[model samples]
Target: MIACSAELYCAADLLTRASLGELDVDIVAIVSDKPAAGELAAQHGVPFRLVDGGLAGDSRAEQEAAFAAVLDELEPDLVVLARYMRILPEAITVRWNGRMINIHHSFLPAFAGAKPYHRAHQRGVKLIGATAHYVTAELDAGPIIAQGITPVSHRDEVEDLVRKGRDVERTTLANAVRLHLEHRVLVWDNRTCVFA
Candidate 1:
């Protein structure tokens, strides 16, 4: 559970599944500042923690230091950013390097960053999608891991597109994480060669 952003309940579902050994991984720790997100971690019997609160306006170095401490405790082989809104520091990006992943709400190299569904709706795109990729300093411009798409039409509103996008985001992220945990995804020069 990250910032507890929209559709964060998916985090609960993913972590629950992972706890049940569906992904052959363990939820060593979950870091979020929100009580609700922390509760999700607790419900899954995962240790919950917090990093930069944003109210202090901490520098990237400070934030990275805090995050490093958390990772030190968890010793996770991979870092998954599910609905985590903050753009991480280059230090943390480089430190984690190929071990980190994120799920974006857009098909990517397209409407990235905040509110992609709204932008796609405004542009009248026939299809909107989600992407999961290795985390790098270049924001959403990272090595592609997986992509999931769903069709939409002129009649669909932004809200409808958002609802549909959530489904894509959830499944795409889950699949990417599962592939990574299973050692089925290989990264090479900003692209992924998935074995399955």
Candidate 2:
């Protein structure tokens, strides 16, 4: 399962790269509340589903349950959270466990959660980075699997950082996914022992 929100850039990047046989697994479906996400799945020749937290606009628990049911039905070996923009409850995370991962825009242990790039820029940080890791209940605090970074000068604006962050996010996430696919990552004590 591949979950996403409004924009499909990250999802498209991952699906495109995955389709090239970099890994043995297949992208069975893309789930989202955004229609454009489903359109992206269609363009990429993958199945799509809209998970609206049920038709009644129910509670958080209901929404989570609906998503969990969808995943249960899909039975995918792995789930990639590509700019998914939703915080899942513990129930689903426990079920997916090591099988789930996400790409965070910051190097992590810094600027975690949403709008990381914007925050990093606001702090006038010189170097920005991206981190891909297993999706633990703690937001973006999972075991680090792979990372990518680039320098940002003072002259560079927030938009510039956001642009550069996108590159880092893409490569970092791809590397992490590749490592996971190849079974090259071992987790312990909330850290990763990545085998080359």
Best model number under TM-score:
2
- Candidate 1 per-residue lDDT over residues 1-196, each given as its tens digit: 2333334655775786786777777667777644467777777787877675553687656665777778776768888888877788887788888888889999998997888999999999999999999989998999988999999999999999988988888889889888988899888888889997
TM-scores, all candidates, are: 0.90, 0.94
Error of 2 at 46 (Å): 0.6
Error of 2 at 77 (Å): 0.5
lDDT of 2 by residue, 32-86 (tens): 8666787799888999988765345767677777678889898999999888888
Per-structure clash totals for the candidates:
0, 0
In model 2, pairs of residues that clash are none
